[model samples]
Target: MAAEKSLHEYDVILVGAGISGINFAYRLQERNPELSFCILEGRHELGGTWSLFKYPGIRSDSDLYTFGFPWRPWEEQNSIAQGARIINYMKESAAMYGIDKKIQYHHQVNNANYSTSSKRWTLDVTANGSEQRAFRCKFFLMCTGYYDYKEPLKAIIPGIEDFEGTVAHPQFWPEDMDYTDKNVVIVGSGATAITLLPNLAPKASHVTILQRSPSYVMSQPSEDKLELLIRRMTWWSKPLEHRLIRWKWLLVPFLFTRFAYTFPKTCRKLFGKAIQAQLPPTLPRDPHFNPSYDPFEQRVCFCPDGDFYECLRSGKGSVQTGVIEKVTPHGIKLTSGDELHPDIIVTATGLKVRFAGGMKLSIDDKPYNVAEKFIWKGVMLEDLPNAAFVIGYVDASWTLGADATAQLMCRMMKQMRKEHVVEVVPRRSEAEKRTMTEEPLLRLTSTYVRKAKDMLPKAGSSGQWKARSYYYKDIWMAWFGDIRSGLEWVRGV
Candidate 1:
């Protein structure tokens, strides 16, 4: 048996040392000097997804210009960054903030139980489960992330169990699995498969990507002149530097939304013109990539590495439009009666989501599950008090949103402390209101806004929680919105 260690407690417990957790800890420490924190990370290292994915062309889907911390923006001058650089960025963040000590590595959380009577939580965790440790904290932030865990996939067709030369998920790619000269079949088209197609096509004999349906893809120069000019600005006030870049790209949308009510046609034309410029008419082929939906509907795919285009031009890559019929011993059979022999198959499928660290939450033991609840102020949950989780725009720079969330969380915590309120929960609604309000929130002008209502933490049908998707409006909201207006309080016992 391993030697027993002393128990510990803290004012706040953050799970996962990834972008969200690390940022939260940093902001919390800065905002509240007296509060104690302990961060529990399952992985041995700092970078979460960045460390986990080692596939050939692994990288961030969003441009690092705004995706990284506001104070430490990516000055690499590339819109889309490689997996390695992202990991390095995380390391720099940990070191710069002195967050290493707060992180208890190899501590995998099994279950965390909350006790409202005591207004604290007991986190039952084990490292490799050979030994266990218990930690108590007044507040818990679930930064395990919506996509931390990998999804399970079956052949869906017959005979996949035996004939497969090599099959794996992109998240769990083996270290020694050689793809050189091997025919590789990558399934799915979300971000992972799109990334793998270009990276693997060169090394492998050939790469065939199977897409159930078409997703919009945009190709930009991997390195742009504008990006080169930005790196020199990183050491300066980084947030201001990042904010300038964010506002620059954000202007077209801002103008469109700001005057859209009065000048819808002109605003629309400006955006349309921008799109037309990028996909110049001189080039042939359908502009499915241009997308019929308005911007920010589903987040646009970013492939600045130019690998996607390079592979297609070289004829080493093929992007098929359709679903899979089944996986044969040797290869995949498409619905179109096409059979592609692949030496290896990778399922880059989507993720399954749960709420609040996937932990069973109880407020005074009322049994809280945030998955189905309405969000308030894009942070707090209804029927739960003294609690909130980070859920940002799935289509934008996630860390940008996360940074704002960390700052907002600090403010909320301060309110709780100042008022001596022990808890804050949202009021439940009747069945008459089953979906989001038809009138969209001002900040959330994106049509993709509709896609996340099930999970977004909105402030209310109005107020900050009303659910706005516009970045500027949210920047305004996060900075100036009356965050405490909707907070229903419970007196401490």
Candidate 2:
């Protein structure tokens, strides 16, 4: 007979050890200390995205002030931080809070099933390599982020197999591979491609960014002088100074996002002028710098202190706007009769969206289809019991949204215990469902988001079902908003 699998029990089971997971862990410890929980991480180590992405010049586009957790202020002088530094910060924070000890690395949750009768979640997880383990919990939290780690979004580059040169994806950048003096061409105009241009340009013989369309690229300083001055003020306490600086970053981006949405034309002109000022005079701002879409329609890419533009000025890097006709053995041929001869090709295309870490979810024997469900206040999913997932903002710092979700999750858990409730789920009445039209969960019109539209959860027109992006609104909702709007609470199992 086969050996029986050992079952471990907990009050809550959190998946993934990324920023969202760590923040949630901290909040849980602070607010719901009585409840027992452990984080199940699939990788050998923590740091999720920061740890996984090993690409050259891997850094955050958002300033560290907002990106860093609210509980722990990023003390570094620079706002935009390198991946290694970010990883170190996360590791240090985890260790400081004793959250690292709660993490069980190499535990990949394959499937999760909720029993309505028992009011518990049973997860089928693979520990280490092939050892099977069972973990049961009252609550399940997925912090796996929105994208797939195993596979990147496959770009449709014709004749890619025919290319004789090396092709690399930013998601899994080869560590030992050297690009020394080889010509490189990076595909896609997203943040990843924009970041790679300046980073690879210095060492490569030449680096060219090949994009079918343009995106808004803005330059900001890595370190804020005003923030530095504020830090020097002896009158203000350390925490007070940090709070003030954080608020400045938070409000500035919030206002700017609203402004972009409200006045697209004005923002466009401002962005165009800024781009023209940094770029070389000879380079035309029309085809390469000009985007058909309005500002923040898609995410605006940021380069610290005009590094991307500086590379262009130095002639070490350049941008080409055209459709890829095909990939030759030697290089890429464009539809516009232009050809790029590069020794290395980097497909910085995009990431593939994977909900709940691509784990199979079910309720009592029925399969849970995420695409058919509507998100509740961007936290819980409709009909998904005692569970929540964290999704961050596309326009602002991701930590702001993650922290809001964490606070809301902790509050809900506390309320559940206070009210003596065994289970809670977001429920939509049939009447309400009839009036609600489905919208995309992700607000962005980017290629990856568009491709995964049908695969993601649905959003409602308004009320508790709308997919939220504004950090101020989300934080307020977490702290003071009513949690019982559409949520159903059960007294006993």
Candidate 3:
């Protein structure tokens, strides 16, 4: 093992050296090898999302063909991979790139205060057994990920807390917790519910899904021939290949998403028919399970390990398509007067998203407010100087955008250094133009919406800037666009 150094700080201070943070570090280092930096990660190891969440059947919902990195071919042939496999890949990347040494394990940064006078940031981080230490640096980059830490959750069920049975959240299931032979009730119908029910089916005596509303579930081939073909072609311009793929998907869903938003019922019928064909003909009819929504409105869940749909074919479990009225001491009571008693309850209700809340950046004695910032090209946050955040793709594999953000950040940094500049931000007018141009795709409200609110660059007075939401357009703007021609470094220019 390389001897770890405890220098006061580096030229850059990165939060969460997961995929985004680690990639950013490498990109910056590649641009300026003389640059010194350190990454502060909350988890004991790397692999941000992959390492933190350890629930059963945990794997990426997105396909690996598009989500996986360009340089390294996914060792796994499958389109989607298991959680453990992905986490290991992350660790492997760190080792391959010598990034592990730059990482400070157990260093959890609570907040950062930026000093314009000194051109540094004082980071308050917890490390070495919760002892808080402050580190100062010239620049701050946050990639802590969007999801908040696991906390106690609440349900709408009446008298639910009184239940004598064990309660667990799929988000933070204990390492030693056992589900075998227990009757479990999974509440909520998002990705977690879709995944948990099947994994618990074999061990649990009975598993019932209680939900208020059902998300549209769409299935795709576990593998894509086009993606396989393209994986070989990624070595070319990363931006070029991404554009080809983005527009390729746009052809099918381009009209569907627009039609769904304009004429909701028509699009819903298209999805309903698809669901009906896959479901059992003899099962009872329930709209909660079969909704009238666009296929990809919310991300669809897939069981890569086993047949996800097969869980329904067998009698091991059932889906209760009704709203939960309340929770009694024993179990959950539905609004339809159906009471489900169980030995354990798992809450898979979706996650709570707080835009800009996760990142606390204080600059020049003033807090950098996300609400006031406009999203530029769906990447950089406005009003922030020498700072960037790498967000994984919501609908696509995070690595798809993860790779793009890394490349673009490095390119911009190189340009800044060459031109001699201290800070750079998107012009408000340009950001507004981009946002307004793509409001339909960039509606500032999806699970990925908070990112736009916090980081989207500001545009013009119209307040409708077009943010290039697609990966291809963003790469061009970030890499090729001459927007930064106006920027002249305050020091040397």
> Which numbered prediction scores highest in TM-score against the true structure?
2
TM-score-wise, the better of 1 and 3 is 3
Error of 3 at 381 (Å): 2.3
Residue 159's lDDT within candidate 2 is 94
Per-candidate count of clashing residue pairs (backbone under 3 Å): 19, 0, 33
lDDT, residue 197, candidate 1: 88
lDDT, candidate 2, 1-493, per-residue tens: 1223488899999999999999999999999999999999999999999999999999998999999989899987778989999999999999999999999999999999999999999999999989989999999999999999999999999999999989999999999879999999999999999999999988899999999999999998976777777778834598888888889899888898899999989999999999999988778889999999999889999999889999999999999999999999998999999999999999999999888899999999799999999999999988989999899998898889999999998999899998899999999988778898887787788989999887789889877998886998899989998899889999874
What's model 2's overall lDDT? Answer: 0.92
**Residue 232 displacement in candidate 1 (angstroms):** 8.9
When 2 and 3 are scored with TM-score, the better candidate is: 2
**Using alpha carbons, what is the TM-score of model 1?**
0.82
The whole-model lDDT of each prediction reads: 0.67, 0.92, 0.65
Query: Per-residue alpha-carbon lDDT of model 3 for 389-480, expressed as tens digits?
Result: 66665455576566677677677666667776656644455544464432332333333344344443343233323444556555666567
In model 1, what is the error at residue 130, expressed in angstroms?
A: 3.3
Regions of candidate 3 where Cα sits further than 4 Å from its true position? 1-7, 152-155, 224-267, 354-359, 426-465, 485-489
**Candidate 1 deviant stretches above 4 angstroms:** 1-7, 148-159, 227-243, 246-296, 428-465, 491-493
Tell me the RMSD of model 1 versus the true structure: 4.9
Higher-lDDT candidate among 2 and 3?
Answer: 2
